[model samples]
Target: MLSGQSFMMFVVLLCTCAFAFLNGFRDASNSIAVAVRNRALTPTYAVLVAAFFTFVGTMASTSFGVYLVSAVELGVPDGIPGLALLLSGLLAGGAWGLFCWWRGLPISSTHALIAALAGASGASALLGNDGVHDAWRMLAGGVLLPLLFTPLFAFAASWVLVIPVTWLVRHSTASDVNGVSRAGQAVAACAVALGNGLQDGQRTGAMLTLALVTAGAAQPGAIMLGPQLLGAGCLAAGVLFGGWRIAHTLAYRLVNIDPLRGMVAQTVSAAMLFFGAMLIHLPISTTQAVTSSIVGAGTNQRFESVTWQQVNKVLRNWLATPLVCALLGGILYLAMHPLVS
Candidate 1:
């Protein structure tokens, strides 16, 4: 928007937009691990298989509720500028995500983006009360809540469920239960695939919905079918690309995952994500959901096995995200305002 031809703007969009794709690759491990690690599917072929299914599911879905995500909340003011808002916040958030990827750290794109949106919106809010209440409530209720809860729910579900299931596995260890576990793998795999569709795919859909509005290709306030389908397709394609570097960190390092743990985590993440998505047509963070699930699963293995250090790191990022984004948004909005005006 700068001088109506800032190459930097386009460049930033290209780089920042990839966060959605990276998000899927990074989180795919939650679903693929049980199948791949357990030899239910070879890594290469398994991801390919997951990729194909994920893509299909996303493309097939409609975008009826896309509005929930295209807009973020923070008690922002009206004069902040939408172009500046989208550009600066996304750049900061996207850069944050890429920075973590470079360090081989698995962080949440949701946290980064939400922080960016909140920061930028709050900066604008200082100007007037145009979009304040709508945004902040959303940040707290829609985006932040799900991301925070994914792990909490995952942790609690696994905490209560894993012990009993583990005991059962031990009990059934005698009579060729391996065969039964193997048999159960197919069904579990399907559930994981559905989880991917509802979980990761929705975030992509939301962003795409916003992009279309920003570009004047669509209307605002409500999400539509086209953007949703497009977003889902893009996300599924991302999963096929594979994010092995960090996926291994999650699946292997998080805990000694077996089929039951993997499936349960996937199922929990999917349940929460899908419900959130359908509730407001907003794309919630699968990264948060699945990460929480893994963390929860880790606790089920014993709190000692749970990586509190990593959890602390994640929490720190979550806490700092908004402040950093707010500062970035304020600075960039001021700088870009005159040019756009």
Candidate 2:
């Protein structure tokens, strides 16, 4: 029979894998929506391409994984309470992702998880598990700041890019332009999928490692290859399943996008994801970056034709996601603590 701590660790690990699947299910559209919209790739092929690249990216590097583990581990207590906190956080994030996916609303799984972790940490602190200082510190520098800046930066950058891209291709024939744009969209879509894999794969890995360490099954800074590969496989499976509800919303409801515009939006979002992961060392939401970029690029040509109602709805959901996940995390942790203890 498993010890209480060992059993709790196993539960947390299972929850972390489920959370990763939700992340990929909801965020897969960020990469394939535009490409599919322009007929650059059929829906089936798109998912396959996305799944392959996502797996590759997840296994690509552990830099972000290490950073995330360090950032989150320091915040919670060790042993059973810590395991409960992580489980609560995972459930909170996964719940929000499912709700949003059902409603076809684009949301940031990364932001939701971060908010949920912080809230669980806060709740644990309230019960005198420990203080909230470390959790607060991690959220401030990692999630909140990126939440504020990434959307605006992605939008502005994509909007401006349309101008120059249009200018360069102005003289080209329509067929020629479409062909080039289609090709570009295909490449950019793969790049975005790769980035998403890198961002989210590491997050799930970190959570799993945290659970093991808290349970005394592993040591700090000891990341095992088996867990990383398992997380990546789960993520890739989710990508293959795809989130067509969200995909339709992004492809048609949010904006009127041509091949050129789709290419521009995806390219900008990919750059931001890479820059965040490698250079600035922050997690950027694939949903926020890609959705905002599409809107920005759409508005460049005919602002009136863009779907304001849909834009407003998506924005409202984006704002609500973190708050909802945080509350849920706190509530779940409080509710589960008594039983676990």
> Pick by lDDT: which candidate is best?
2
TM-score of 2: 0.96
**Which parts of model 1 have CA positions greater than 4 angstroms off?**
1-17, 60-67, 71-80, 127-133, 182-190, 221-225, 279-284, 302-304
Taken over the whole model, the C-alpha lDDT of each candidate is 0.60, 0.85
Candidate 1 C-alpha lDDT tens digits along 144-191: 665566567666875676677677878576335555654455445555
User: For model 2, what is the alpha-carbon lDDT of residue 146?
Assistant: 76
Off by over 4 Å in 2: 63-73, 131-133
Q: How far is 338's C-alpha from truth in model 2 (Å)?
A: 0.7
TM-score to native of every candidate shown: 0.79, 0.96
lDDT of 2 by residue, 45-111 (tens): 9999999998988887475542464424555578888788888888998998998899999998878
Model 1, TM vs. native:
0.79
Report the Cα RMSD per candidate.
4.1, 1.5
